[model samples]
Target: MNSAVTSRTLARTDSVRPFKAGAYGFVLLGIGHLALSAAAATATQTSERRAVDTVMRESTFALLGLERTVLDVFNGMSIAMAFFSITCGLLILAAVRHAPALVQRRTAFGWCALAVSLAVLVVSVLLLPPPPIVVLTVTSCAFGLSLRRATTVSAHAAEAA
Candidate 1:
């Protein structure tokens, strides 16, 4: 899941599409990301990862006057990323509950989501594997389709009004 979408895709607009997409899709993805990270952290390491961990532990680097190993930095970064994703997801969900008057108007909410998801999709495709790439692709399409439908509905409303 893209942190940018979890953090920035939701706007204060009155759009249920935002709520449904963010709550159903993005929030679930965030939780899944955190769960997967926790699982990986606890699962027995593969030989490749174990070897890397050994080498990483052997080397020490100074950061802020404290000595840290590569493994320390790597683990810290991974945990932080997972924490950030779940945090954003929970926050968005909270917003959905507390803010009930979010189904009357529309804004660029989906555009923001689509943009960030697309960018993340590209990066995932280039650097990561298929799982993340597929997630991003699905998210991008959701946002785009939601945005299109929202616009079409609102446009008809404008005509009727």
Candidate 2:
């Protein structure tokens, strides 16, 4: 019932809420990235199969060009995205374990990382297969949320100090 105890409790609660939100947001972003990669992989396989069929029917090697090269790059990128997503997820899990301690000091770094990731997501969506717009959108939103939460938590922690 002491005022000091109540203030401490409130401060702790407020500090934790943003960290929790940011951690979950990062996790969701990772999951969405993984899903996008999986979908891209499937689409790439299908397209490759179709290309083989067309080549067989036409009996020509004339289908090689910039478009084909771009598709191949996109295919490779899907694998890269899968790895990135898993890595981000693990990092977020670690942050969750450490909570305020880990996230509090790295708020700026986290924001920068999220911004870069969002930019990559946008570029990938533009250059890659088309059906996973929802995945990209969700991932973007989650990263934005994570950045917002990190900023809020960092500001609150500074004020408390």
Return the top candidate by TM-score.
1
Tens-digit lDDT string for candidate 2 (1-161)? 65554443334323334544444544565566667667754674676678865564554332455334444554556567656755765676576576654444446645654575577568758875543445455545654554444435546677889
Indicate which candidate wins on lDDT: 1
Worst 10 residues of 1 by lDDT: 100-109
Model 2 earns a TM-score of 0.48
Please give the lDDT score at residue 76 for candidate 2: 58
Backbone collision tally, model 2? 0
After the best TM-score superposition of candidate 2, give how far the Cα of residue 62 lies from its true spot, in angstroms: 20
